[model samples]
Target chain A: MAGIFKVKAKAKDGVTKVKMLAKHVMETGQRKDKKTGEIIPAKFIQEITVQHAGNTVFSGQLGTAMSKNPYFSFTFTGGAKGEELSISWTENTGASATETAKIK
Target chain B: MTMHRRTVVKAMLACGALVGLGAVIPGAAFAARNKDAFSSDDQAKAMQALFDAEPANSQDIVLKAPSIAENGAVVPVTVSTEMTGVESISIFVADNPTPLVAEFMIPAGTKASVATRIRMGKTSTITAVVKADGKLFSTARETKVTIGGCGG
Candidate 1:
């Protein structure tokens, strides 16, 4: 199955910039369907982590306040070109996914 | 017999308290511990739950957001700092039902900066708090929201 994240990273001037877009609905459990008039259950990313060479560069604890299809951008020092960065995330509902991308 | 995830999580929390900050552990316990912060509707409750201390306003950090966001559903925000030994950056929207938006951890050697989009319920003050070198520093800015995003 295709991963739920689109990750891109680039290295320049001894810094690696990483940008990611996660696929999620980010329901807050407050909205109600027009037909059913019932509250929608909340589902969102509870945590996300990015690792370079087994060291954490960025990790996030997210809530429903984040917009749908959350996007994040961050940078770290000393990533070489073509080096692989591992990214993973676990949702509030216990679902998770992992993906990797190479620094350009 | 397999150990329940929640049981292991409880153990992780204990380990964290046992070992100052529990930097040695390698699980998602940090996130699990802050689960209550996500659901907090009150700013003080969320702040205390997340940092265990009050944050002081500082000029060292930069918070970038629109003065007036036409669409509250997708407001872009960025937090950056020149301070060294930074640990984490957290965003909060005062008017949202859940004040805490997100918290990003910055490991050593990583730049103390992050960018993301968030939802806002109305015109509100958005605060960015940075924990660096064991000190909490923060900055706030007002974003006028014409269209609320909470879908409520």
Candidate 2:
């Protein structure tokens, strides 16, 4: 399945900079459903992992405090043009998705 | 400057040794996510669940956060450190309904820096904790939230 993430990696000066935008509702449990008036259960991406050339480069755990459609950016050493980079995320609901990009 | 370099070198050597040891133990580069900490309203409980021990104050980590957040819903936070072998970095808000905001794992050769936004329920002490070479270090700063976030 295609994950809802847009990633771009650019290698320059021996460093690779990565930027990503994820499409998610990031529903905070405190919000009440407009119709039902019941709290909307929290649903958010709880974990994210990034790999390059089969090696883990970055990972993070998130919570409901993050804004909707979270944006993330980071830089790491040792990346080359055309290298494979993958990002995978797991949500609180146990759903996960992975997307891949090629370093430029 | 020389003293600082010496300290950094010593720290790096210590980290190098620890990283070697971690390689021998599977899953040592990462820490399990603490769901309870994210759901906790108590700061102490959240800290315990996340680190299993109190973090020591440190001058190494640089935590940048607003002194007064005009909007608590999207308070920008950035954490950076020069410490090598940085295993992870975590953010926490003392007064939030759920104190623990996020945790990030920094792999080897990656810069120990991360930027993100977090919600603040009210005026709070925002803490940034860094785990480097199996040692926990932290720094905290107070930020006044003008508009409550997290559904007020």
TM-score for chain A, candidates 1 onward in order: 0.94, 0.94
User: Which runs in model 1 stand beyond 4 Å of their true positions?
Assistant: B1-31
lDDT of 1 by residue, A1-104 (tens): 25788888999999999998988898888889878899989988878999999999999989889998999999999899999999888887888888888899
> What would the per-residue lDDT of candidate 2 be over residues B118-152, giving only the tens digit for each residue?
78888999999999999999999999999988762
* Per-residue alpha-carbon lDDT of candidate 1 for residues B1-152, written as tens digits (9 for 90 to 100): 25688899999999878765443242246545476677678988899988889999999999999999999989999999999999999999998999999999999999999999999999999999999989899999999999999875
Error of 1 at B3 (Å): 46
Residue B113 lDDT (model 1): 92
- List the lowest-lDDT window of 10 residues for candidate 1 chain B: B20-29
Worst 10 residues of 2 chain B by lDDT: B22-31
User: Each model's DockQ?
Assistant: 0.60, 0.41
- lDDT score for candidate 1 against the true structure: 0.89
**Cα deviation of A42, candidate 1, in Å:** 0.6
Best by DockQ: 1
* Poorest lDDT segment (10 consecutive residues) of candidate 2 chain A: A65-74
Residues A1-104, candidate 2: write the lDDT tens digits. 48688888899998999887887888778988888888888889999999998889989999887767787777899999999899989988889988898899
